[model samples]
Target: MIQRIQTIFLFLVVVCMGITIGTELWEQAVNGQSWKLSAFAVENLSADGEVVSSSSKWYIGALAAFVGLLALISIFQYKSRGRQMMLNMINSLLMVGLVASVFLTTNGLNSELGMEVAGSYKVGFWVILAAMVCNMLANRFIRKDEALVRSVDRIR
Candidate 1:
């Protein structure tokens, strides 16, 4: 069961979330300096002279980690395709929330710093998008499996 296609897709989902931890989804430029916001940290790339580091919002990182771990755990629940589907749905919601929170945070940061934020989406954002798609596909496959099992039982 661990060798199931949905398991592989779930693992890919986890990898995408893990990679998101290190990549930025948006970039903002304030006074000619660019600041890229990632899931775990924000880096302020100074254009003129000095460099400063920005700390991360712990909850965002925690949510992302939770989603990834959820997917990983979902892979093991082969006995319960329904449960796996539920987990995938939950993961999907978590990812949507993560994206929304990121945008909200960027808006707050922009106003605080008097700058405009732009979609300088790095590798991380795209990965998140991929995870979203994978989650949907996993759910589809889980439902398919469940239906197949039901039909087999009916035949028996």
Candidate 2:
């Protein structure tokens, strides 16, 4: 059961979240200066590639890590398809929240600096989307497995 297709999907979600944790989610270049946003913080870099300043964003990282943990836990719940599906659903909501938090933070950063244009999203942001897709796929397969089990029980 643990070797099912859903397991691979859930594993991909975990991997994506791990990548999100280490990479920048968004970035912007303004007036020859650049800012990079990661799960833990945002760093303002000067033209010469020096850290001009940094601001904390620990909550984003925490949420991403939580989603990853949920996926990992879901992987081991192979015996309970219903519970695994529930965990997948919960992970979906958390992923949405993570995206919202990143978007709001990026907007806040821009407004605080009086910038009219928005920054370009980076790998970390996209990775969340990929993880969300994988979560959905995992849920679908779990549902199919549950249905199959029910059908088999009826046949017996």
Candidate 3:
């Protein structure tokens, strides 16, 4: 069961979340001031590359960790395909929240720093989106497995 294609996708979801938790999501330099946004904080960096100040965003990291936990749990629930599908749906919602939280953080930082627009996204942000895609693919494959099981049951 662990060899299922969906399992691989689920594993990838976990990997992406780990990266999201550990890396900076966005970066910008304006008015000679630099800033970096990560799951844990929004940091103002001095010209020499030092953290001048930081505002905490621990909730974003918490949400990402929760989503990753759900994916890992879902991977071990292959016996109950329906439940696995439900978990993935929940993951989808949580992933959306993660994205929204990141966006809101960026907006909040822009306002605080008096910037016209937010900076470009970095690896952490994109990786979460990729995780979402992988989650969707895993769900699709789970559905296919469920349908096949139902068909076989009917034939017996």
Candidate 4:
């Protein structure tokens, strides 16, 4: 039952991510605003500085890819009880990555694109947060399964 819930949650997360991408693209097309790519300076050194930055769109794409991968893994593991536990761990880590990417992209968009794109950022934040909660619940289910297996083994 928990596995089933997790599978559903994963599907929802994928849908949310898709919606986020779609909304952003629609807004850009309707407004006639070109997507801006900007570089952020991570470190400042004398005159020349080392910058580690990615475009707002790139980060959104990355988050979508990560969530999609996790959703696929969840579906694959649905058939097997043992594998679900491992998949849950992977999903949790991916969720963390997704959330972080949302924050990074939100900050980047605010700085590069201004308040005009704030709606997209807000929607992305909520979706990512929901995904995080779902992933954490899935992880808990995995732990519960582990304990159940151990108990059964001991009884036998």
Among these predicted structures, which one has the highest lDDT? 2
lDDT of 2: 0.96
Give the per-residue lDDT of model 3 (tens digit) for 50-123. Answer: 88988888999999999999999999999999999999999999999999999988887789768987789999
Name the top TM-score candidate: 2
Q: lDDT values of the candidates? A: 0.83, 0.96, 0.94, 0.55
Model 1 over residues 1-156: C-alpha lDDT tens digits? 788789878999999999988666777676778887777776787887455777767777888899999999999998989888888999999999988888787777777777644535667777888999998988888898999999999999
TM-score of each: 0.89, 0.98, 0.97, 0.59
Clashes of each: 0, 0, 0, 0
Clashes of 4: 0
**Residue lDDT tens for model 2, 1-156:** 989999999999999999999999999999999999999999999999999999999999999999999999999999989999999999999999999999999999999999988989999999999999999999999999999999999999
Better of 3 and 4 by TM-score: 3
lDDT tens per residue, model 4, 1-156: 434666676677677666555443211111433332211212112223323332334655665666767666666675575677676577667667766655665466556545555433345446666766766676576566667878999999
Where model 2 places Cα greater than 4 Å from the true spot, the runs are none
TM-score for candidate 4: 0.59
> Given candidate 4, what's the lDDT at residue 120?
37
Cα error, residue 105 of model 4, in Å, equals: 3.3
